[model samples]
Target: MKVFIPLLLGSFIFIGGLKEGFVFLFSLLFLLSLVAMIIGLIRPSLLKFSNRISAMKVLFPVFLASFLIVLITTDPVEEPRTDQETVQEDAVEQKETEETENAEEQSEEQKNKNEDENAAESKNKDNREEIHNEEKENANEESDSSSVNKQEEKQQNNTENKNDSKTLDEKESDPSNDESTNESTDSESDKRPSNETKGTTATVTRIVDGDTIGINLNGTIESVRLLLVDTPETVHPSLPVQAFGPEASSFAKKTLSGKKVQVEYDGPKRDKYGRLLAYLWVDGKNFNEMLLREGLARLAYVYDPPYTHMSSFTKAQSEAVNAKRGIWSIEGYVQSDGFNAVESETETKQSNNSSTASTETKTSGSSAYNGPYNPQGKDRNCGDFDRQKNAQAFFEAAGGPEQDPHRLDRDGDGAVCESLS
Candidate 1:
């Protein structure tokens, strides 16, 4: 500890007139002083420099004063140093200070740079969101304009259709003026036959299904089915009849009983049923489109050319399903029927609670259309009715009750099926 003070004083003087030998001797003495201080601290009795403790304390103070005086007085007056070594030390210290200031400045600049970058990025993100919103707004405006135009066009068409219908009705109702009206209609039709195929020429001979009809083409009768649409059948003939089958058939009959239609073939001339599959034109409008717009049919084709009207068809179907129109109104189209054990547990609880239970229970939970009154029997308790759409479709395709490929009810309990019922 004593050496620290003396060494600092000597270092300043060492740069002056002090020789290397003198500096070395002074440094050695300072080192010895430190060793003595350490030894005194560790083992006070081992130190032999002073006798009495009072004398030693007083000696230390005196020695410290004398040492400071010697350092102050003995420094020989000499010329200031102009050596390369002195210049290098000053330069090194100045460079060090400059480096420290530069580091601090750099740290502050980096913090500001990060803040600016983040602000820019946040602004850019907000701009992108605003641009997206603007695009959406434009699209909505276009859609509204298109819808308004479509409505106006539809109203105009309806008016024209009603007028044409009335004209034909008037001509047919009055047999007296029928020849003159027919001659005028023929003249008008003849003028446009080359440009448009007149549907009135073809006479419908027989109705095949809701969508298909047999028409006298030239001389031979050709079976024509409307394209891009499907309708429920009284009996698939290819598949099977489903629920509301007769209603679907009746609706079709009422709509097209004696209507004239122009055919536009899209794909193969005929189906496996020898039916001409094409888009039908009625009153200059596509009947296939009418079925979809009326929510009476679903767009059935999924692949290839059918995709032309797929977007519009899908949109219409989505609207119908969302509105729960027609088949979509029927529950259990794609829902699941869970485990039987869980269902049985619930039924057992219900049975216990109910009083006056019937003796001829007949597996009351079973949905079997067996009895006379319950032709579509216990199956009516369709907790799983929501799943019937797909199930019914599959069953109809595989030949329902009459010719089912897999006898669903293996035990022959007068229940043709049981899996989902």
Candidate 2:
């Protein structure tokens, strides 16, 4: 009976165990029943519940029959999608595919357009260069012919003077002609000034900033950054406006604006920004060297080999510095270094997670922070912060110290200046 009960339970489990959740639960119950029945059979003296055992034997067949009936009636195949749903899914997939193809086509068309424009520009530039070369050749030929004509004319005049020598001798060296020639020379001198010849004439269109100007050289306008000079940065993109930056620019305007100047290139014709780098000569003076000499500018040391006017300009700048001129007059202007300050801030941010929790290096000695440093003092009481990000930002800005004026992360914890849990 025990062997037969286990075989029956196994058959019932095989039939209905694959149906769903409840089928597995019933299978587990049948397995336990089979185990109990075997134990009861092995030791009839152990199991005292005779009535319950007989009831289980009577219920097993009925339960197995019921399980078989339910398994036969249940459907196993998955439900099919409706026609409308299937159509909608197909439309979405097709739309996505078309969009991808359209994007690819647009990108290819843009690339082709860019290539065509570049080729057209190159061809135009080549044509312009060829035209310029041809014009230069024609001009050389004309000048050569004109010089030959002038030489012939001078020779003819000499021959005519020789032929007229006899008439002049008869006239007794004509005092009237001599007086007329002297009068003509005096009149010509009166019309022409002694300071007539100026250098390469360029009309100054605009002053870009201190030490920089825009001028029409020949016919084309070009930007000129003065060589051997760097004024206080007024129009600099990355620097704060300096106290004397305006004064320097005003000085440049008063000195050189609207004047015709001469450009003299040193080593390189153009700087990296394509500005013509030159010593601007205005009114018989080198304006580039003048800027430093007058203390309106500083002699920057960023020049290359064969530095055009390095020593002279450096001496000028040293004199300017000692005299406390222009930008140097401002107490902290010369001392203020935004670069080191920014670098210190960056380092503080990166080293925030260190075990010390404060900045790896103090801000005073390394950078331009200049904030009072007292690491052992009371909490500097930078106000409460809700978010850790804002606190960390302020902490970095406040010189990144655990015990500085703006206290952040007082407990020397990695989290600085915030109570955000």
Candidate 3:
């Protein structure tokens, strides 16, 4: 009875477990069945009637049990579209993750690329600096070489000058010179003349500044600075040195810096200093004239004939002086206090005093002019007249009139400045 009760309870529990899809109960049942078969084989008395079923009778029940087992154990076949959709969702999620990882990788790659570019730029900058340093070194070397060449040339010229001087001294000392027999007097004269002629044109070279220049005119090397006209100083180390200095220097440089200038002999070809005397010319423009015109230089008219343009130059200087343009802009500039000042002020007075004086003058002329000068009135026309005078010139120019509320027709009664009405 106890065994039967246990068997009944176990079977009920097994069936209940199968309903819940529990595999443990089914496995327990299978194990129990195997044990029962083994016991039945070992001892036939152990087999129960319930367990020993007829084959034909059990076939349908076995088939139903098989069908139920299959129904419970086998997974349901899902529709192809639904399965595909789930797979695609998972695939899409994986793809998104992959994309995110790829994006991160790409960002890292771009960052590395930027770092590489920056490093390359830095390397290139360093290389450029090195190249610049090398170029500067080369330039310094070239400059040194040029300086050495110049020194060598200067030494050579000095040696030649010394030799020439010695030859001249020897010739002067001995009157019965060897050249008298060897060379004809005409030939000597011709040679000397040719040498002098060559010296004149050959010595003149190039102008360096407004004042000075190298020349190869007259078979000898010479330099002449200009005379009379004082140009402003350039090449100063300190700034704010002179107001018009650069302008003056530039003007001078532009006028005469480079040219085969004709030196109109001022006094001697040079002063006691042995420089050339000349008014410089580039093209047809005279340096002196330019300096005067630009107000950079004054016509230093101490001498005549040479100072022929003195009057014209002085006139230009006066205009610059009057306008107070360049040098004349300095404080306390002088001007002639003549009829010019009086007439100019009369035309344009800076004060209301002139306006008052004009009215008083008009009052003295005629008392019947009871118009603009009626200062004792407090009417709207009077206020309007004042406003019109303040705003428009036409009203003030003609003197105000009475009976106009707008007071716009202060001039010529019916006219309103340039307004047609």
Could you tell me every candidate's TM-score relative to the true structure? 0.31, 0.33, 0.27
Instruction: Give model 2 RMSD, 1 decimal.
Output: 33.5
Prediction 1 global C-alpha lDDT: 0.50
| lDDT per residue as tens, model 1, 61-165 | 554554554565455778778798799999999999999999999999999999999999999999999999999999999999879756655554454323211
Candidate 1, which ten residues in sequence have the lowest lDDT sum? 334-343
- What would the per-residue lDDT of candidate 2 be over residues 183-271, giving only the tens digit for each residue? 54443322211232323678787665677777888887677878767676544422333444556677788888889887777665665
TM-score ranking from best candidate downward? 2, 1, 3
Off by over 4 Å in 3: 1-209, 235-241, 301-306, 332-421
Assess the local accuracy of residue 146 in candidate 2 as a C-alpha lDDT between 0 and 100: 71
How accurate locally, in lDDT, is each candidate? Answer: 0.50, 0.57, 0.46
Largest lDDT belongs to which candidate? 2
| Model 2 lDDT on a 0 to 1 scale | 0.57
